[model samples]
Target: MRILVLANFGMGLYNFRKELLKELIKNNHEVFISLPKDEYKPKLEEIGCEFIDTPVSRRGTNPITDFKLFMNYKKIIKEIKPDIVLTYTIKPNVYGGLACRVTKTPCIVNITGLGTAVENGGVLQRITLYLYRISLKKVNCVFFQNEENKKTLIKSKAIVGKNMVLPGSGVNLEHYNLMEYPKPQVVNFLFISRIMKEKGIDQYLEAASYLKQKYSNVNFHIVGFCESEYKNKLTNMQDKGVIEYHGKQSDVKRFYEISHCTVHPSYYPEGMSNVLLESAACGRPIITTNRSGCGEVVDEGVNGYKVKPENSNDLIEKMEKFLNLSYETKVKMGLSGRRKVEIQFNRRTVIDTYLAEIHNITER
Candidate 1:
């Protein structure tokens, strides 16, 4: 079987879904990926995938550009004549699903997360919903990362066809194996995500600034690419010894090595927070928002604490609560997190589900 995948970027596919792609090839399936060409494209080729460089505007809503993207998908689908198409993220799912439906091909869409505009409602939400409603009607299956996200779409009548909720793209347990729980004498808290406003960077920075002034033995570390506006702020903070801002990292495990906890303060709509999952898999406790994508990972005080979205006070309180915990208690929490991932979010389970769904659709 020939399977084609559409996505916004290369790292998202390479870092998160590479194992699935490898398994597909091992099972003797021909795999093709349609995405914007990037450094990871060469690595994807190394895994036996034939790469199709498809330029995508990830954040634009321009009708003309979107029409071109749709046309590109239509062209790719027609030329490749793939047995099935799999799409991830918003643009690909909408446009690729449309192309597949028109071409009379089986398509599966993975709703990684509803975008901020779609979730916030209003004119954009209405437009996105209308598009989703039309595009999803003909797809073979839709995969959602979180139950809340799935429910929202269903309630909004955006997706009425067959769909199933998946554990947020499941973590690669082997790749992020459990590490020995770190000593928290001088606790290091790491924040991993795009340093954008919607991702709760403000909340994190606020919490960090307030906490750094109060806690003498704690450190805050910011990871990922900083947005333009936040650049000077991060630099100033780092200069003042408030936080360590590593521009961007390909290997987060090294940072995780020295860190005691992972804090994702994102209010952004996400199918599931892989940052939380990977942190847990690395045997580190997580502090994240008490909302859908981030909420599902924490078991109250078991693995980590949850804070109210966009509330700096709540975030500060939680971080303080985490700081006061005994070192042994922190280790236990890390162990609980590792157990959660091993039992509930192993990547093999996610891959099996994908393969099963694909086979079911193809056999039909």
Candidate 2:
């Protein structure tokens, strides 16, 4: 089977779904990946996927640009005439699905996250939902990363096709196997995600500020892309010793290994947070919001704690709880987090599920 995989970013494909693509090749399938070219395009090409550059402004929602993106997909899909089309993220799922529909090609869409447009609930949300409904109408299958999102899509009548919930994108257990928890003199807390307001960076910063003043032995570290608007402010905070910001790391495992705990106070409508799962797989306890996919990873006082969304005081309170914990207790919590990922969110499960669906779709 000839498979076409579509996404907004090539790096996302390289980092997250490279294993799946390799498996398809091993099964004697020709794979083509379509996304905006980035540093990772060569990596994807190296893995035997024919890379095609698709026009996608990941942060833009301008109609004219989006229409061009839609037309691009139409042109590419028609030219390639792939046997199966698998898409991820918003634009590819909506516009790419629509283009696939025109070619009468089977589409399998993975809803990674809804993003702020849908979560904010406004004219954009309505427009996005309408596009989703129309695009997904003729899709062969829809895979949602979490039950909350699946329920939302179904309830909103955006996805009326066969749907299944996956464990976010699933963590590669072998790659993220348990590591020795850091025994740093200072209790270090880490936040790993894109530095966006929606990701609850403000809450993390606020908690860090209060905790730093109260406890001199606590260290706050951030590892992720610092968005333009927050760069100067984060730099200021770093200089003042309010926090340690390492902008956009490719390998977060080292950060997780050195950190006492991982904090993800994200209020973003995520499919599931890969950061939390990776941290868990590395035997690091988590502190996150009690909403959507973030809440599901934590077992509340078992592997970690769940705090109120966007509430700095609550985050501070949880950080204090971690500070008060005995070293053995924290280690035990980290081990528990690793056990949870082993039992439920292994990447092989995700790969097998996709292969099974691919077989089913192609056999027909």
Candidate 3:
């Protein structure tokens, strides 16, 4: 079987679904990946994937550009003639699914995140919901990362095919092995995510600022790409020594190794947060928003604690609890997180699910 994977960004495929693609290759399936060419292209190529440079503009919401993207997907699907098409991200899932439908190709879409457009609930959300309803009407399978996201889709009448919930792309337990919790003199709290407003970055910053005044020994670190608009603010905060901001790190495991807890105060609708998953896999306790996908990862003070979405005070309270806890208790919390990942969010489970779905689509 020949499988064509479509996504908005190339690196995302390499980072998250590389194992699944490798599994496909091991099973003797020809794999083709279509995404905007970037540094990760070489990595995917090295893994025996035929790469097609796709023109996918992540920030382009213009009608003409989107129509062109649709046409491009149609051209690629027609040329590749794949046995099954798997898509991720917003534009690819919507436009690519439409192309798959038009080309009479079996398609599966992974609802990674609903995004701010849907979360904000406006004209764009209405338009997106309508587009999704039409585009996914004929898709063979729709993979949702969590039940809340699935319910949102069903409530919006977007999916017309079989829907399956996955464990948020699932974490590679071997790659992110559980390690002994670090026992640094000062407590370290790390936030790993793209610096976006919807991701509750503002809340994290506010919490860090307030906590810093009281707890001089505690350190706050952020590791991810800061959006252009938020760069200056983050730089200013870094200059003031309020937080240490390492812009876009490829090797996040090193930072996780030193960190005591992972904070992902995200209000953005996510399928499941990869940051929290990796942190847990690395045996770090998490403090995230009490919302779908993000909230589901926590067992409420078992593995970690869930704070109210966009509430800096609530986040401060949780972080304070971590600071006040004994080192041994925190280590136990970290171990609990590792256990949760092994039981529910292992990457092997995700790979097996994809393989089964692909076989079902092709064999049928």
Best by lDDT: 1
lDDT of 3 at 271: 86
Off by over 4 Å in 2: none
Kindly report which residue stretches of model 1 are placed more than 4 angstroms away from their true locations once superposed: none
Candidate 1 to truth, TM: 0.99
lDDT of 1: 0.92
What TM-score fits each model? 0.99, 0.98, 0.98
The lowest-lDDT stretch of 10 consecutive residues in candidate 1 is 177-186
Ordered from best to worst TM-score, the candidate numbers read: 1, 2, 3
In angstroms, the error of model 3 at 69 is 0.9
lDDT of 1 by residue, 1-364 (tens): 9999999999999998999999999999999999999999999999999999999999998999999999999999999889999999999999999898889899999999999878788999999988988888899999999998899889888787899999989999988988987665699999988999989999989989999999899999988988899999999999999999988998889888888999998889988999999999998999999888899999999999999998999999999999998999999999999999999888888999999999999998
What C-alpha lDDT values do all the predictions have?
0.92, 0.91, 0.91
Superposed on all Cα atoms, the candidates' RMSDs to the truth, in angstroms, are: 0.8, 1.0, 1.0
